[model samples]
Target chain A: MKSDIILAGVGGQGILSIATALGEAALADNLLIKQAETHGMSQRGGAVYSHMRISDRPISSDLIPGGAADLILSVEPMESLRYLPYLSETGYLVTNITPFVNIPNYPDIEKVMEEIRKLPRFIAIDADAIAKEVGSSRASNMVMLGAASPFIDIEFSKIEAGIRTIFGRKGEEVVNLNLEALRRGRQFAEENR
Target chain B: MQKHLFLGVEAIGQGAIDGGMSGVYSYPGTPSTEITEFIQENPLAEERNIHRTWTANEKTALETALGMSYAGKRAMSCMKHVGLNVAADVFVNAAMTGVNGGLIVTVADDPSMHSSQNEQDSRFYGKFAMVPVLEPSSQQEAYDMARDGFALSEQTKVPVMLRITTRLAHSRAGVARKEVLPENQLSLPADPRQFILLPAIARRKYKGLLESQNLFLKLSEESIYNRYEEGAEKSLGIIACGIAYNYLMEHYPNGTCPYPVVKISQYPLPENYINRLDQECDEILVLEEGAPMVEEMLKGFFAKGTPIKGRLDGTLPRDGELNPDLIAKALGKQMFSGYAIPEVVANRPPALCMGCGHQDAYVAMNEVLADYSKGRVFSDIGCYTLGALPPYETIFSCVDMGASITMAKGAADAGLIPAVAMIGDSTFAHSGITGLLDAVNEKSSITVVISDNESISMTGGQDSSAFGKIESICIGLGVDPAHIHTIVPLKKNHEEMVRLFREEFAYNGVSVIIPRRECIQRASSRKRNKK
Candidate 1:
């Protein structure tokens, strides 16, 4: 029952928050979760990622093997391609269309997106556009997460409940916005899928 | 409890909360930054009235935590391994000036130079300081030991160090929650003479430290961490540590590992375990990260170790880190060669992100220094130092934090004047101030380029110490207002910035050119959010 899920993205992208939400959702669904986060150079436009593993059974390991992830939640398209190796054979890939291509040597967006589309399982979404229309682009990651929720082992309400308390601790305003983000993402997924 | 999940960093912070910490003081450094960030963000911290704030750098962090400890409170200071070097002065001495309160210094070591100039072992600092060190095997242990670390310090009359490698620092495990305890009420030191570290007082304190060895050895024997795991009847005996212990078990997943292993995660190395291992197997592999300190010590204690294999024998790479395959080879097991990562063309590695102020600072330094027949730029530790690598290559020296200014002073005094001292905003506050004071008093003609990125960019965008004060610090240090010029470090303003650098290069006294700009990477993410 010891399995692994690796989530990676740049900082300021709410990648860590999305991972937190996922971890919470898994826990709420009655799973044992162990997530490790490593982000430095994240301040320096460096890539940030976390290794999350949830098991219905007791687990001993924290890290996942290459290509072992059951789901790849890509906040941005390039990140999806970058983390393609971690995807299991039957894994689902939920990605947004925004490109944060800061690295000069990296291939163009079209090339990277083309590479991601070539992968076995990928679901690309304009999560950023959805977030933009909602006037809060920071929720782009949550949008992608909501779009991917039905595919994960856990139900969406558990994720919503997790998000409620998480943002509830801050204020009622953030809770409302985050809930709206979830709804918009779910709606996007229902319509598109 | 609804089975709350946690990030490894947040878990450490949560562990601290569960372990009962009074306060956390730190300067953000990668890998270790989240420990403090989590504390600041967690609602429990606010509800429980916990304290969390970013200090100037590691020195201030150590000193502030020491101040809290002085008040008889449980305090922790965290930073990357390199930050230990900055805190070394106070850190080494804190052992002699034992505390009424408990102090735990957490250092996250970077292996393979991830966001660090070098991968220095923090355990070496523990040895140098003669302080007790604890390494946790998993996230749960990270919490347990973190709590124990404080009491252990109190028991030994010295501060304790929690040394973790990148793997352990970044890895997570199911950490069962321990009962949270109440915070230790702030109390004062009993004896006023306890902290008077003058030579007159230090001699006895040093003697006191030596006298405490018995206590250290006692803890080493009974530490909950050090374990003698029984292995299958066969091949060899292995002495594993931290993540290495995890891998040892992983390699022998079927529980048929053909070796008797003594996995240790605590300091001073239990003598009983060593004697038992000595009687047990044909060969011994001292598996550890960072240094061969254990191998060197084991050789001194146990005779020849039945042909011990590690860094000394070159069975493993003397430098860098050890992984499962490397451990397998050391155990003479078949190695799993990884998938071939194709090499790319010899292009310059990433220097600074576009619109980054550090880049403009470098560009200005290079442009102005080209005017001089001889140009020497002494660089300190920060994101700005990345200029030493790529298209910019402006800085020459990168030793420790604040090393740039002092190193520049030395070179300037020895006929290398107009020496450019390039340093970061956070670094200037950390160690740069003392060097700046040195430069001013000595009248060292060094042109100091304070690359004010408004955040500690290299260490993952923690608040920069100079967020409010940099000009006044220089002004108070006797740099004239005329000499202290500022410029916004965008690409379009490079020409004007170069003009400023040229002017500073000609100044007779210590001149500061503050190229002020928010870190592009930092601004991009947080700018949208209302603080």
Candidate 2:
């Protein structure tokens, strides 16, 4: 009945969309939710994170303390590793394999994936490729959300409904594309994990 | 009752609206910008014709809000902690003048300097001004306090400060809306000379302000926001202030901390609860979000009192935001840290966006300045301040808003010929105009580069007050028309921009080079909206 999720990614990568969808699902289920987001200067291509906590009980802190996150759901490969310390011993580290190589010192992609692979409970998926395969390349965050959905306590249908509700204003076409991306990502995690 | 998810800032905005606020004024800054933004977008505000718009800066915003309050309408002026510094003159004086209608000065402090230059606690400002300061521990409190803050202000006839740190300001939670109140009708203060703070009047007002401290304290003592929770354990008394209470409660999921807790959201320190805790417990641990104001007060100058532990005593680190883990550690709980980040994960500092005009502006400025000494470019706050980062580390200084021009003028005056002042359009509108005037009045030898991105660009592309008028403002400011050059900031115009920079740098007087373009983020969002 509780999930402490760390949504990690570079600024402008739409990690907040994932949080919004999850928050929608949590609310629809009549659960208490708290989300702390990074704003201002950090949003200018900086490493940004949102600490999202959902529980049946009243959530106290907006932040998920280090080593308490149920899921570290990240849109980028190295970005996922940035929040490794926040992951609980039993938590899942779900991240896209796509490396957002904005910085010059971005470590080797293979090496970064090697570290992710070292985790006992982790799912590394090519969310970008799957998102592109589904419809829009912009829906990679949704795909990552899908990959991490299994670890989240919320029902899958609620997450889908959440996406639909969030993207409803964008019209059905955009909604379906994102839903498809989500499904494809879930499928990838199911088979791989 | 229906519940809606709201960021702390959004909750305040909604609460203000529901509390019959007639106007909300602010200059956009991180964590605080969204408060004004929420009001600006609210349908009720639009229908009610509430005054919601970006001001030139925080000072103007507070002054205008004060003016609105003079007309006996509920008004709110919000700004980040640093913005309070700009508005301090009016803020401190407003206490002496008091208010006709309820006035709430909401200040969001940035602890850990998330997007700020300093981690100044605004609660100190509240204490300095001798006003009722409300710091909400939860979004619900934020909503309730903001909704009722006006009433408290009116009852006491002093501006109430609702202070929040970045965590609470940016965090989100479900907030139920309260019954909407009607705005106060237009009426003047009964005392015609109440606001006139002449020396003769000021002395009486100052005494009244001092005398009213007891009422403020009584209100704090009786405040619904402040609560005393008894615990069996008296070894440690914890004074958790504002959002720090949340971190303390996070440790005890069942909402039962062994130590007696004095949850203080309303300040004047609420001495009654603290006195009980002080007398009851063996030692006190002052848990607060920003600086150890409460902690210092408890310990006194000599630290001879109760064993007070906090940032001052090194029980908590001196700086940075507090987390549950830090609180747990202070409580003698086993720390929980998973794996350390792999050394390969690189630090990704914030940088100018891919198509940011600041990049081209900095590029041309760097190219031109490569010929001169490196430490010549003085910059102001905005997206252009990112130029101090890698690739084009052209800016030597990034101080407060509008310090660039004046600093450059000072450097130029000191014989650093052709000193460069790099600033942004929004900042140029904020305080840069005054500095430019100062430079002009002296005809100081400085090349001022106004990177006009047509928007604030920082804090999420808020509309700049100087939009479409940077050129005209410069011309009006008495900068020679021939000396002011505007160029498109693009690779194609790189040569031209460099040429203009070179020309202005050699002018030996106040000259301006404006690189005009729309912020790419704003441009892209505009296109998206168009679509």
Candidate 3:
């Protein structure tokens, strides 16, 4: 079955890279993929989301319905809740437990986390800690994707292929390090299960 | 296998690839920005050797595309609908010149005024320019028309306008890809005299463009873009054009909407489709966006229909946008009556983009120029015009495109001094250049601050026309280059900007200050990338 998945987050968390990997993975599995983004605000510590809809059949309405999404893939906690209404009641939320509370006017991190701790159906991971352990804070979203991906219907092989597409022309080490992060996330999820 | 998954904006770019456009010149504006951004980000553009660049503003983007066409390469320019007004001068004139290669201009009309100053229809541009226009109902059609727009422009020897609403521009769809046709790479005109706008040749070409109605109508009849979709003809027919067709079909799938529909994507008022639609149906309801262009034209060509309902004639509100719910209401279906509609007087206006340079500029202007009447601020169109809001309700009138500068000049002539005109660098190049020239030539006393943010920040951070040359131009225009001050629009330096304004106010003749800074949006974008 084809479903539309929207990944929204602030930039620098690799949101575009995630959308690219997801689109490639879906395409590898032979599903139709349509993804669009708004970059004007993405670069400015502002909200950014990639609307990705994958379907087995042709479709209209490029934007996902306000609250009919099957899964909400978010890199940050607040971003997950930002698109919560788009998720179906039974929809799973795959997100990181880290707080990126760097908004200009509001600078209190713990205050922001207190509010975000209340969302339902959350599969939270200390992505920032996991990414730091992996030698790159930039990989936090990838670690979260690694943790939450088991709940998705997409195959691991497809994600691997998609990851290769993103690593494009880079050294084997660069690709292997990210692969290790994905493995760590998957291993943690299975062991916890 | 060609992938079907593509964004509406990506599909538009791919359509440009298929449509054989040699270049896509645009400045980023919300909704419409992704087209150029995607073109740059994607690998296909480079593989095809397509020339896609972010121009300074709508006018410069249009002019650049026009230059490409003059060189005999199919070219396209794109922007949000309000940008049409910025490019209207060159845009309206481009119709007269026509082109050797195809020229297509796409405007993403932000209906409901989302990410816009006003929700205006680009259809008016088609009627104003006398050019054939096309509006796509879906992402598939967005791609299809983008490719075909070139053919239509070339066949008619006039520029083509492709219009899409915010939904279509920002939406995503599974667009099946077609093989890219090699573009028609043409050479320069054998005679350069043809395009040089000298009165002798331009007069003749202008007449030729006016007499092209028959050819335009012929092309309209043969249009592959606009067609009559045959369905069961009933007492009621649906005339859904552009994205309205997409929403209407979604609202009534399969047998529910068995009534015949005239899906007029291409324009010049497709008479054949309208004639068939009019002959079969007893009543017609026009479901089009941004003004009653089609509805008005249909009445002009044929008058026999009952209860023709649309944006005009009180069928729908004459202002704002049209959606399926409105269409449903017009078709005698009940719609959700929401919270009592807020009255216009009671409605609040837009504010600055939280941490925007425009806000800083407005704060400085309000503080320094409090002596002048609060309503006397001469403002140009941009996010800076948001100063007309609370906290800094400094702008008086924001009429036309670049009238902010000249409107202040008129005030200066009538005994207003120490007056200020704030125009963006991109807009200064667009139309403010000539206005500044007039002020300098006639010796009108005005202090104009060319807020040189190095880009057009409003329509989504397109390049600035005076990107590196604002100072040179101001000096060339006979204003002392010393008065051309630069300041980072930070609140801490409001005094510096304010002091520069104070000094320029004393200067009797034309004075310009170049407040140089990168648009906060673009600057923040660069900062995020480094992380």
Top candidate on TM-score is 2
The residue-level lDDT of candidate 2 at A153 comes to 91
**Ranking of models by lDDT:** 2, 1, 3
Task: Provide the lDDT at B320 for model 1.
Answer: 81
Query: Clash totals for all models, in order?
Result: 0, 0, 6
Best by DockQ: 2
The digit string of per-residue lDDT tens for model 2 on B1-531 reads 779899999999999999999999999998799999999999999999999989999999999999999999999999999999999999999999999999999999999999999999999999999999999999999999999999999999999999998999999999999999999999999999999999999999999999999999999999999999999999999999999999999989998998999999998988999999989999999899999899877887776677899998789999998999889889989966978999989999998889888888888887888888779999999888888888988989998999999999999999999899999888989999999999999999999999898988898889999888887998999999999998899999999988988888989788998888889999999999899
What lDDT score is found at residue B356 in candidate 3?
72
TM-score for each predicted model, relative to the true structure: 0.85, 0.99, 0.79
* Weakest 10 consecutive residues of candidate 3 chain B by summed lDDT: B339-348
Q: What are the chain B TM-scores of all models?
A: 0.93, 0.99, 0.87
RMSD of each: 4.3, 1.0, 5.6
Candidate 1 positional error at B160, Å: 1.6
| Residue pairs in clash, model 1 | none
Superpose all Cα atoms of candidate 3 onto the true structure and report the RMSD in Å to 1 decimal: 5.6
lDDT of 1 by residue, B272-357 (tens): 88788878777678888788888887674546446676788788888887765566677667533422222221122335776777
* lDDT score at residue B517, model 2, on the 0-100 scale: 88
Computed on alpha carbons, the lDDT of every model, listed in order, comes to 0.76, 0.92, 0.73
For model 3, how does the per-residue alpha-carbon lDDT over A1-193 read when each residue is reduced to its tens digit?
6566768676546677777777788778877655656543234455667767777665444555555566777777666666655666566666676766544343244543444444455565677788789877777767766775676668987887777778867767767767767767766665653
- Candidate 2 Cα deviation (angstroms), residue B189: 0.6
Better model by lDDT, 1 or 3? 1
